[model samples]
Target chain A: MSWMHTIFALILLPAIATGMFRILRGPTAADRMMTAQLFGTCGVAILLLLSTGMGNPVLLDIALVFALLAALATITFVRRTWHGSNKRNHGNPL
Target chain B: MIYSILTLFDIILILTMLWLAWCLLNTEDIFKAVVLFISFGLLMALAWVRMRAPDVALAEAALGAGLTGPLFLSALRRMNRTRKGERRLDSDENREKEHKANQEQG
Candidate 1:
């Protein structure tokens, strides 16, 4: 069982690295946002795998919290993007 | 033997993850990239399941793949339309001049 955790970490490490590259090097703001979301999700998965490998239930709450936070961050980004474009369309009445 | 079987599944899961990651990186269209990223999230969930982390798998499927992916794609679509509209608003004479300039420069 412990080996399984190690295996997953090894498997996911490269994927996470590639995602980080996208987050850093993405050409557009939207690309960076998507990459950041991917990284957060992968982090949660890693935490869960580690928690289970160690037979500890406490980490489940951490995973949940991380998921909620990631969702909130994505929502904020979406709202900001929408508002920015709306301003552009309306000719910046402000 | 059971342990070996489990390891084999893990290997397969890892391979799938790599493939998804490749797709996410190489897709040209932003919309397609978002879709591939979501698929990558789903594959990650399966990888977690194979590793015996059901809780993580659920979170990955729900929050990672499900909510975030669609949110990003819709946002991208809106951004694309706004950009297109801005370009369309440009006067035709200006557009033609710019096109001619580009041809001359190239």
Candidate 2:
């Protein structure tokens, strides 16, 4: 059963790695941000799998924190960074 | 079987992290670099978990991925605004100098 969890975790790593390419070729800031969102989701999943695989329930708490922080980071980026830029710089397209 | 599988996972995780770090440093766009950095922090936390350091993983995810990313983004925005302001101020100063020279000539 632990092996199963480990295998699944291994499979997800490639998925996140492929998302890195999208970050690299992004034509806009939003695209790169979305890739980061994907990374957050995958990170949570991998953490959960590891918790069960290693028989250490403590990793579960780390996964929960990861999930929360990921959301916070995205909200900060959207509100403080992206939204403010458009409104504050009316004449410029920054 | 378990040993081999774990070894494979470790190898893949290390390679992915290395690639991400390389991209984060070399990317031309600061926004992309910030995003890559957040992702890298997340991966680094996972690496700590693999090393049986769950406490460190928690800290990395919270501080590195969560806090540092927003800080960088805000800093980037502020820097851009200030640079534009400075450029405009420079132009205004040049205009003032030209006006003063014209008055002196008159």
Highest-scoring model, DockQ: 2
Model 2: how far residue B4 lies from native, Å: 1.5
True-structure lDDT of candidate 2: 0.85
Interface root-mean-square deviation, candidate 1: 9.7
**Clash number for each model:** 0, 0
Stretches off by above 4 angstroms in model 1 are A85-94, B1-106
Which candidate should be chosen as best, given TM-score against the real structure?
A: 2
For residue B32, model 1's alpha carbon misses the true position, in angstroms, by 22
lDDT of 1 by residue, B22-85 (tens): 7668866665566567656756765665566777777766677657875776677566865774
For candidate 1 chain B, which ten residues in a row score worst on lDDT?
A: B81-90
Error of 2 at B101 (Å): 28
User: Could you say which candidate leads in lDDT?
Assistant: 2
